[model samples]
Target: DARVTQTPRHKVTEMGQEVTMRCQPILGHNTVFWYRQTMMQGLELLAYFRNRAPLDDSGMPKDRFSAEMPDATLATLKIQPSEPRDSAVYFCASGLAPRGSGEQYFGPGTRLTVT
Candidate 1:
């Protein structure tokens, strides 16, 4: 009965607009991840956190994108000056691990369209 939840399932904005997506991970889960999907890159991990602390975000564009967990249950992704190339489905997933053997449960996703 545990599930991840994301807000504003769809968004449309002109180029240069800022976009923010939010997620609520399942309670008691210590790990959360953000991923972006596109035809070219397929599915890429943008960021991940454990125990509400960011572990890595090198796959994300440092200048324009950021990921963070402000509290135990909430995670956030933000893009400033969004571009057409940034259009994609962004997913948030949460899981617990025994060093990489656990299953991650994903939220529905936020589909963004940058014009």
Candidate 2:
């Protein structure tokens, strides 16, 4: 199975800045999941509306971050007023089914740093 690809491999920005990560899911996949990773908290789920787990804003800061699948092949995550604490590797997983359903393609990840 092919994997999703993230852009810009790395990003660095100051505090209070905004960061946006784009993910292109595998073709024909109807379900997409957003996630974040940091040394302090491992990997965490951000959002999944059409997913099976029915997870909604699981741990993401609703006021600052957004995850949406605007179209069938594209999904996006935007963080406004990004803080130093928000620095982490963001990625997405895509599959025909929802979270924990089975095989899901993982992205290479977009590294973000808010200085």
Candidate 3:
């Protein structure tokens, strides 16, 4: 069976550090999504891409956060000068398109904590 995977499932860092999270989407999937979950903001779609091209990233902080698909199987999220406010669980999900009715497969998210 195919499944999405993420690395460094948990991380704790001091403020002003840089954090990088990685994801491997399910094979053959055409779309990938990144999401952040926090107590205040709840679950927000940070970004998504179709066929490895970013579709939208308006929900992410352009200055400090970035999301990208470097190749067909890999997606990455990075935060420079990470702050306590940036602590949250980040998730990666993948799905096929055109059918538009199936559930997206989600990776076991990466949890980040900044002090």
Candidate 4:
């Protein structure tokens, strides 16, 4: 019964508030991904990692978004001084796809609302 779990499933914050979200990836999966979905941008990859090591984060806004894997099963994404434009659903996914093609099992996303 392994699956990714996310905390604070829903969040509402005033503009400029710092927000942190946590994810517990499915055991045995080495590759983790962070994604964001908004009305304008359909699900977009923000970061990708293998063995707790970051492989790519080009899609993430360098100034405000950060993603990290501190341990095998734990990953986190943080936004400091979040803005209304940052309001969106953030998702964490994990799977074995190093060969380059595999479907990701997504956790229930964290819905953030900024005003």
Candidate 5:
């Protein structure tokens, strides 16, 4: 049984610092997604990758948000020059099936707070 795992489930940092969050998607899954959730934005799709290739990232703020897949099971999301508004729960999800037909299994999430 494989499950998505996230690191640093809770993080508190001062403003303008770099933060890195990681995730391990389920095995045999090729599609990975990064999402941010907050009071203002219920669930914002930041980006996704298919077969380690970026599919779409139009929902992410290009200035400070970045996502990458270093390998098959590992994915990462990074925030630079962090701000208070950037504080939220970041989730990494993986699709067990095709990009459109699969249900996404989400990690526990990494809670980031910038003050």
Candidate 6:
């Protein structure tokens, strides 16, 4: 069966360490998204992509994080010089475009903890 897969299921790093998370969306899904959830802010959409192109990432801190689809099957989110406040669970979800026509498939998610 097809599924969304995220790498390094968990991560723990010191304040200045860089973190890289990866995702592989279910095959054939053209739209992908990145989301982050923390106790304080709840869930927030960090990035959106369609057909391997990034469409929006305004919800994320531009200087600290980056989201990209290197190809059809792979999506990546990276945080450089991570801070303690960046601790959170990050999720990658994929679905068909045209907005809400189908259900979204989400990966188990990558959990990051910065100290």
What are the per-residue Cα lDDT tens digits for candidate 6 across 1-115?
Answer: 8899999899999999999999999998999999999999999999989999889989989998988899999999999989999999999999998865778899999999999
Clashing pairs in 2: 13-115
lDDT per model vs. reference: 0.93, 0.80, 0.94, 0.91, 0.91, 0.93
lDDT of 3 by residue, 19-91 (tens): 9999999998989999999999999999999999999999999999988899999999999989999999999
Backbone collisions counted per model: 0, 1, 0, 0, 0, 0
Looking at candidate 2, the ten consecutive residues that score lowest on lDDT are: 49-58
Q: Please give the lDDT score for candidate 1.
A: 0.93
**35, model 3: CA deviation in Å?**
0.4
> Please, what is the TM-score per model?
0.95, 0.87, 0.95, 0.93, 0.94, 0.95
Q: Candidate 3, residue 111: CA error in Å?
A: 0.5
Q: At residue 112, what lDDT does model 1 achieve?
A: 98
> How accurate locally is residue 26 in candidate 5, as Cα lDDT from 0 to 100?
88
Q: How would you encode candidate 2's per-residue C-alpha lDDT over 68-107 as one tens digit per residue?
A: 7777777788889899999899878887853446877789
lDDT of 1 at 18: 92
* Residue pairs with clashing backbones, model 6: none
Q: Please provide, for model 4 over 44-98, each residue's C-alpha lDDT reduced to its tens digit, 9 standing for 90 to 100.
A: 9999899999999999998998888989879999999899999999999999866
Task: Give candidate 5's whole-model lDDT.
Answer: 0.91
Candidates 2 and 6 compared: the better one by TM-score is: 6
Q: Score candidate 3 by TM-score against the native.
A: 0.95
Q: After superposition, how far is residue 61 of candidate 4 from its true place, in Å?
A: 0.4
Candidate 5, residue 75: Cα displacement in angstroms equals: 0.5
For candidate 1, write residues 1-115 as lDDT tens digits. Answer: 8899998799999999999999999988889999999989899999999998889988999999988899998999999989999999999999986575588999999999999
TM-score of 1: 0.95
